[model samples]
Target: MAASCGRRRGRFAGGGGGPMMASIYSMVALVLVLVACVELGDAAAAVDVYRLIQYDLAGSPFGSRLASLNHHAGAFPFAPGADLSRTAVIIPVRELDLSFLRDYITNSKPLGGLLLLLPQKISEKIGQVRNILAEVEHLLLHANIPYPVYFAYEDDKVEALLMDIRRSDIAGQPATATTGGFKLVVSSSEPKKVTSPTISNIQGWLLGSKGEGDANQLPTIAIVANYDTFGAAPALSMGSDSNGSGVVSLLEIARLFSHLYSNPNTRGKYNLLFGLTSGGPYNFNGTNKSFSDVAKEMGVTLGIKHKKINVSNSRVAWEHEQFSRFRVTAATLSELSAPTELLESAGGLHDTGKLVDEKAIYRSVKLVAESLARHIYGHQGRNIDIFADNSNLAVNPHYISSWLNLLSRTPRVAPFLSKNDPFIAALQKELSEHTVEVHVQHEVLDGIFTFYDSTKARLNVYQVAGVTFDLLFLLVLGSYLIILFSLLVITTRGLDDLINIFRRPPSRKSKAV
Candidate 1:
């Protein structure tokens, strides 16, 4: 009887194990199948989106420079076969300026559009480039010229093509001679009106005093930088020089202050204001706005209420320290002038001492920098001090559209701030030490970028052919659900059987014994 009971128990166990094993195997198979199907579906649905952008490979002297300019312009120059009546004149950057623009508008024939070719060399004199572009835009607005002005960077291949066209059209006539007709004409009408300029000001502050001080009453130390930049032509007006270094430095300084002043327990006595102003190329428009806002918040009129704020006054004068391009000195200006002379002499052109008045331009830049600095720190009055690095002065003549590309090939030329610059070292020291007094004898200068000639483009599209949903995905899901249900049923039945086996009133024979 014992042996018979043992055999019955074994048979029951085997019966239960068979369905359990089948269910486990079925679940594993379903999961594997589902994973495989999902992956396959994902692969099938994936698509690659590509855009066909034409580049002036042969026309551009430097491949990257032209590519960058084209990217900024949003489109390539009009093709040769394009309608000339609807096209505009292409002016080289060298020919663009206040005087040249005035002459062109007054003397040149009616035009449909204008394309200015910016030179890559303008990257050296970014501030002057911006100023020139701004001056150009101002002239156009004043004259009420409605034609659309576009800017392109100078390219060798494009220039060659243009020369060939001119040669063919003139047919043995001197290249310098003009037919006296309209150089460019288009069907488009004048623009209706000029839109208002948009200037954005970014500001933040850290409380340094221990008590909850009235922000308006506290003496403020403002650290500022310009965030906007521009190039000469619309295509080359990338203000990387102004926006990249100056703004980056301001942000770093702000971050350090934030970390230091964040603790309420150890706050300093003075309030720290960080201002990152935009519209740098537009006569420091952003900075001007910032000053106005600061005045309003501090409850004091900038020039009226306070000629200079004293520590005893309820509204103490605000101290401003601005970070900008290095100041240009007399020696540097001379060095910059030497290059132009050397270039003209190299081209077999006589040095007329009038190639370009480098001294006058440098002086103008210096004056502008000084005036802007004074305006920013005017509140400080007699107490104001401006410090900067003359060696790293912002001087990029090729910032506009011109034929010259001065960068060396072996070691590509670029605008860079040295790690060991004394100005940088001094600024860093002041920030790290949190010193209230900083002394440097150098003058402060601001760099500007042109926004008038810049362009923007958007590339967003979908490839409809690649999107798909397959039956295999559904099949795999269905199989998974079915396997899951089967496992649930198997588990329930196994538990019930085990419980019944244990609950079955002890066999009558065993009970009787």
Candidate 2:
């Protein structure tokens, strides 16, 4: 068969072919074809999935937040129904490597989702980490794979980011008095009324804090985006935890609830509002005066009370030593803690729920809201809760402390200092004051992928069966070339041997005959 086939192709001299040679060549070709198919099948089965991590100034709060489905997915593949899929449990962070993600994906085997973390700026400390994450994401998309993603953060940390840097510096300066700093000089031509206020006339002077917002504006707050910049303060910043993170958490919860309120499936029974405050390198000045200013405006415009308003400072220490030497007094602590507890009690969640200082503030805010809801609904109102959902509370305590030191040392690089020329003296002063506080800080933010339910989205693998003719043709051509080469060598050697026999043995053969 092989000889006939080779003859048809003019690959050999077509004459002295035998059945055995034909069978050998046929078997050789079949084995080669089978080997090629097996190799191709193995290659196809070795497909890969990539994991991506993203980070911004703060950790990726959005990435760390696990979806409801995540819990379900995590509870899979175990006899006890414990999903035990640690892969989906560990949120993707922006500074992880492809190998790490690959292993995680393999172990968990998720039902197609994607986790998007905040974008981390390329810096010397983490450029390589960021690149690896990017490459993994690229590869996964290339392979047409999907996965779920989430992010998380605490609110108080964001509050620190939004602190009024100008005020902070001025307050810390030796030239200040009474912990006093720059004061706002409000200039207005409107006359102030002593008691009886006139209608449609600007006459109110708000010296106290009270609800100034409209009754209809859904109460909302901003949450910090999870990033490395949040958490504990830098050494230079006096190791103060910024309350901006707290504010951020509040905002996010409000935003999320607002989203829920708008959803057709879960809408109504709640009103939500949100506001984005300042964060990042410049300092917390942006959001520092936002609430107060808003309240003042409301009091002036509407006949509302604005009194006893204390903007929760994210710098409030949560630790015993920090608190012992902190500016807050025991009486103030009592007041703060009491209100927080009251709100918690009002929310009807529990009194034993414990968290860090900023997280406590977040809980307090939610509790306050819940309390108000109960007050409006005969003390048996439904639960209306919120959280500083994005927190590195899951991280190691020592790491948190070091991060606090870094923030303290971050230098007043904003409103008070020029971007081109840092306030070297001020920075030097902060560093020198906290020289012993410097430590390595690692901020871990969660990365996320989501497989949302309903008709909103869907994921399924669609495969088309067809022949890979090009590869097949290439393999066949190469096999044929190899066989043809072997045949040429064999035929050449045979011809040479035949000629030699005919020329040298002619006399012996004639004698024998």
Please report the candidate that would top TM-score against the real structure: 1
Best by lDDT: 1
Per-residue error (Å), model 2, residue 246: 8.8
Q: Which regions of candidate 2 are displaced past 4 Å?
A: 1-430, 433-467, 495-513
TM-score of each candidate? 0.34, 0.21
Q: Please, what is the whole-model Cα lDDT of each candidate in the order they appear?
A: 0.37, 0.29
Please write out the lDDT profile of model 2 over residues 400-434, one tens digit for every residue: 33433343334321212222223323322332232
Clashes of each: 31, 98
How high is the lDDT of residue 4 in model 1?
A: 100
Model 1, runs deviating above 4 Å = 1-87, 95-101, 107-109, 123-142, 170-199, 211-218, 229-236, 240-246, 262-266, 278-513
- Residue 293 displacement in candidate 1 (angstroms): 29
